[model samples]
Target: MRSVRRTLRTLQGDLARDIALVLLADGIVGVSFGAITVSAGLPVWLPMLLSVLAFAGASQFLFVGIIAAGGNPVAAVLAGLLVNARHVPFGFAVGDVLGRGWRRWAGIHLMIDETVAFALAQREAERRRAAYWACGVGLFVCWNLGVVLGAVAGTVVSDTAALGLDAAFPAVLLALVLPSLRDKTTGAAALVGVAVALVATPVLPAGLPVLLALLALPIAFVLRGRLDEPAHVREEASCPSR
Candidate 1:
């Protein structure tokens, strides 16, 4: 159909470039995750499996770190789940773009940070759908492939952190959120989030601090609501009756 062709063209053009950048970032971070996981004595196939199944970069790192530290597997799973709790809200925010029926099943696997950010950046429904799928599937493939490559190379590259690969994941996230920082409310929320995370980092166990940072969200929303109410009341009071 003509609609399908137009969609495909848009995907191959604008979406492809954005997805390519995401792919490269994910690939590098995936490689770092793979190498670090292997260096911690995990089998190469383990990380490759995680890349396909688990697929969340932060949670995967936390899982691997906990295991490597001789922490309980149960604890690792709990921590990973806690860190990934943000996806619950993310699923709600982009539910429309997730498609219907069996397609929703596929979309669930793709519901990570990058895909969510890219989708939200779009103003139009169709473009948001396209961006989500393109970034999600592309990053998934690239991440897995990089995992395989890095797992193999782990034997040779014992010092993955020395190569500065540790910064890749946060860098990608920063890039995604930077645009939204231009807005005052978003910027304020970000500052609050950073402050909360930093303060909690020393007191809480690895992943818990990030989860704690999410407390800023409700606070920001409530504050914004209160600020809007007075202005709304003032505007109504200023209006003259006919």
Candidate 2:
């Protein structure tokens, strides 16, 4: 009991900051999603469920777009899964901080990009937990609020096309992916995914290109090992001299 209280106390500030930031960021993005959802002719509740349950902005956007584009539900779900597969690695990276048992499960479920980034930024385990929960809950509330607001207002808003709501998803995705291009390998992988998607666009359905992008993962893994070997060898050689 004492330990729990201590942990909670340590988390207070980080929790406040993280929740605030996440709410702000997610609220903006949620507006985009809500706008698109309304324009796509989906039921208002659909966006609400998506925002509340899915809680993954990119995946929710992709799912709605795929469905609106006349794609199958299976295809839409698969595309969303492929797009979010990166979260699996992010979860692994933060596993240590997540602790074990129920807390671990909570941490994993809440391990979105913002939560992961904030938690990883913290040097202490306790701080990481606080940050994660703060962002996670903050994003959840703000995201759902935006979805509801957009859905309700969307019905009355005219000329969704004129508003260019359809472009929001791609623009947001590009923004999310662009910053992660830190190295040649990752850059090449992203380039290849885009190229593959473009080439497959005509041949495949709206959601299929996403799957093709996922297929590039194995190739990246192979390349990653080869890319790291030279650096590892150089470090080993230098260590012997010391």
Candidate 3:
């Protein structure tokens, strides 16, 4: 109980405000998801189950959409897996914030884009740890809670789209990462990722393009390293060693 209290105490000020805003947005989207899924004639348990099991908004929505469209269940699962492939890098990036043992495992389960963004946004290790867990646990609760409420009210709100809740997730995500883009390396990486995603979107399946955009990170990093290398070192490397 004290540990939980300590965690909550640390999650104050701007970080707390940011987390609250993000949670509100995600909760609304979660509600939208539940309402839409139920309205599409899926069982009330489906969205709640996916929230706990998958915990990924985009992939879950994709799965529900595909399944609702008469897509094969196997295909829907595969699509969800493909869409979630982006989490591999997220895991790598967020490994530092997650401590050890059960906490690490729980943190991994909560390793969504928003939690990751908040974790990475913080400078100190303690702050990052607090932000990640606070956002993750809060998100898990709010998402599931919202789903429950939406499921109960699903019949009343047959058209979740009319609420414009879908825009909240992406808008909040963009806001979270936009500040980081001011850095040259970060900006270059983002540009490369956007270009890659845009180019691949036409040719690849819905989720594969985003996964392919991860290629941009390495490309940008390599380019940045080359550019930042000393001219003398480059010339020396280009010449034969004695």
Candidate 4:
């Protein structure tokens, strides 16, 4: 009984730690988007709403940027949707571990980059849940707070571009992607996506490059099985010949 109680306490502590860390990271990320929203001439309330409802940081930033740059609303929506379509696969991969019923739905909605990363790092089901919820809720609160601050401060700043806030979007994306490249396929896919986006940027409309980039995701997913097999075989070969 004592051992069980001790284990429970340890788990609770770990959950708390994970939640706190996620909140901090998310808050910082939000500040970048909030600044961009302000610079893009959006109202404070608009960014706050995006932070709360849109929830996906990269998509929100891209949507606001496109709209500010004179892109059509339909284009902005399509671009944002295409950029975020990766969540579909992420949801499927983590579905079983997220459990069932309403909690599963909640998990799906909260399945952002940070939440997925923290969840994947955990070995146990209970730990995964705790970490995921921690990251999600933490990101939600901190991101909103950052948005509020940025919106307010953005008005007073003379030159947002001069401040280099434009770099924030790519920086945040790099943070998410750099950690996930465990194999050649993932690395190659990321490179291809980047190249496609860059090449399409000049030829396509402001928002269409995002859609073009998304065209690569399906290819990556289809090839994932074949890509993993080589790694698996390599690992097996490296094991002791017992």
lDDT for model 1, on a 0 to 1 scale? 0.81
Query: How far out, in Å, is residue 162 in model 3?
Result: 4.9
Tens-place lDDT digits, model 3, residues 161-182 = 6776567667767777888887
Instruction: Please write out the lDDT profile of model 2 over residues 47-73, one tens digit for every residue.
Output: 888877777877898899899998999
| Residues 58-124 of candidate 4: C-alpha lDDT, one tens digit per residue | 7897899888899899988998887787687678767776667876776677888777766776667
lDDT agreement with native, every candidate = 0.81, 0.72, 0.85, 0.71
In candidate 2, the residue pairs with backbone N, CA or C atoms under 3 Å apart (3 or more residues apart, or in different chains) clash, namely none
Order the candidate numbers by lDDT, best to worst.
3, 1, 2, 4
Model 1: per-residue Cα lDDT over 1-242, one tens digit each: 56446556667766678678768867877777788899889887889888899989888988989999999999999988888888988899999998789878998999998899888887788888888887887888888988888888885444557766667557767776788876666678878988988999988876667767677788768777877888788889888752
User: Each model's TM-score, in the order given?
Assistant: 0.82, 0.62, 0.87, 0.65
Error of 3 at 160 (Å): 5.7
**lDDT (Cα, 0-100) at 29 in candidate 4:** 57
Top candidate on lDDT is 3
Q: Which residue pairs in model 4 clash with each other?
A: none
What is the lDDT, from 0 to 100, of the residue 131 in candidate 2? 68
Model 4 — TM-score against the truth?
Answer: 0.65
Q: What are the per-model C-alpha RMSD values against the true structure?
A: 4.2, 5.7, 5.8, 5.5
